[model samples]
Target: MSLRTVAVLLADQAAVFEFGVLHEVFGIDRTAQGVPAFDLRVCAEHPERPVNLLNGLSLNVPHGLEGLLGADLVAVPATELREFSPALLTALRDAHDAGAIVLSVCSGAFLLGAAGLLDGRECSAHWMNTVDLAAAYPLARVNGDVLFVDEGDIITSAGTAAGIDACLHLVRRELGATVATTIARRMVVPPQRDGGQRQFVDMPIPECTGDSLRDVLQWMSEHLETEQSVASLARRASMSERTFARRFVAEAGTTPAKWLVLQRVGRARELLEGSNLGIDQVASRSGFGSAALLRHHFTRTVGVPPSDYRRSFSRALSA
Candidate 1:
């Protein structure tokens, strides 16, 4: 099979780390194990311009935006400038119009927004720039909490390392878990992280005591099938509901109810992927109460119906 082409757009004062991530994932040839490798090119707006990098080093890009036409995937690394050049935006718009996957790392989403690509799409950028991105592009649904957003043809990630997560996720969605896992193992990073997680959280260290909320969290995970509520858990922990809620959020980085729902949905996904159980049985085991409830939250969180996810994974396992 022919190789896929990926183009990385370079600009002045580029973010070196984000550029490195694009190079690491798509620039390198990883076809020794029959994995499809990308044909990578670093293109600039002007072929002979000296590009100033974050470090003292400079680079001269040989190809200009014309290279974007040959790319199956086009990446725009983060930049220090809040606004992008009008010419660069036009090139990106043309690439997207021709059916290429346009991706952004960190503040690169700002470029996509400036190019009018994010007008009706949900996108993510660095959490620190969330306010500015929102104010600048009121038409875009800019989510700050997630690591990334994969809108099929257009993907955007939050900060530096989140670029790795977004790329791995695209690999998984396009290839499969096996290929994504292999790539992640080679890169020495976690294979998967749900996109809904907070970009950063100040996890409080648990007090060294026999009575701690950490123990309660473990217990809750162990007994997910049972009815769990904030008041009931607080009573079992021997603390007032208000204090328990505060401590839970401080330690866990999310509300107790939201956390419980996430855990339940996670369990449901596992059962759906690994078992041939009916929807009702999967729902009961995952503590979703009923199949209707399972369908509602599963589609809301996972972005697909439970039946579809099950069928896709089941086919993969069989193959």
Candidate 2:
């Protein structure tokens, strides 16, 4: 399989990060490092038109659907799912039918679904949107748990970093492991993450209906570093242990232990992104008790090590 050319499809309200993922993987020239350079083209429905992103930025795309001609791969980045032109959708299906491997990132799967390209195919999307994707495309098998699903010719990936994983996997599959590794090293991501790598599920704190439960939730958030069991919490809330457990789950939609862990991880993210605290200090402040435990939960919850997350998201410290 010769992988030489890539066409990235963009639409109005495109996701900048997802588009950046494809551009990072195929647009950059790495021939100096022995990795093959791809003939990457950015395609839109209207050539030389301003393609808007949700973040108020826009790209002056130079190519239209015609740009997909003769491409080895066509990548669809996340964009607004409503009201895509019939011509553009036809171009997408035609590209796939013409033997170009088609890949979608994040909500981009919806475009493929709308194009009738995802019918009866196993796919993935941002976990938050998996239900909608499955509902809209009842014939498509949507696996919300995985980072991406590779169906030989069609690849559907979850949001953001998972797009990187899928693109790197494609590089490894068609180009070679060495080339993928070279690209990954330059992107500072794992060369070959398991396509089944878990997507990060954002668990926001649920609102409590009752005053007591609301106060307890606030207290728990404020004292995340301290160890507080159901019994102690029940006493503080003036309720029986069983009643407290039931009430907690009813209010939070999760068990007390699980909610506490989520809160701790959230706090850890805040500390990692905002402060210059070391790992051990972060663990202590976030109630993980030790750095090892913090690392385990942080990696599992956030899809990256705390250190890596910090490197990418942390604010610069003043010298």
Model 1 TM-score is 0.64
Lowest summed-lDDT stretch of 10 residues in model 1? 201-210
Off by over 4 Å in 1: 1-3, 203-319
What does candidate 2's lDDT look like per residue over 85-168, in tens digits?
A: 899899998998899999999999999999988898999999988999999989999999899999999999998899999999
The prediction achieving the highest TM-score against the true structure is 2
Per residue, candidate 1 scores C-alpha lDDT tens digits across 248-316 of 887777888888888888888788888888999999999988999999988877666888777645643
Instruction: Give the candidate number with the greatest lDDT.
Output: 2
What TM-score against the true fold does each predicted structure earn? 0.64, 0.77
Instruction: Show the colliding residue pairs in model 1.
Output: none
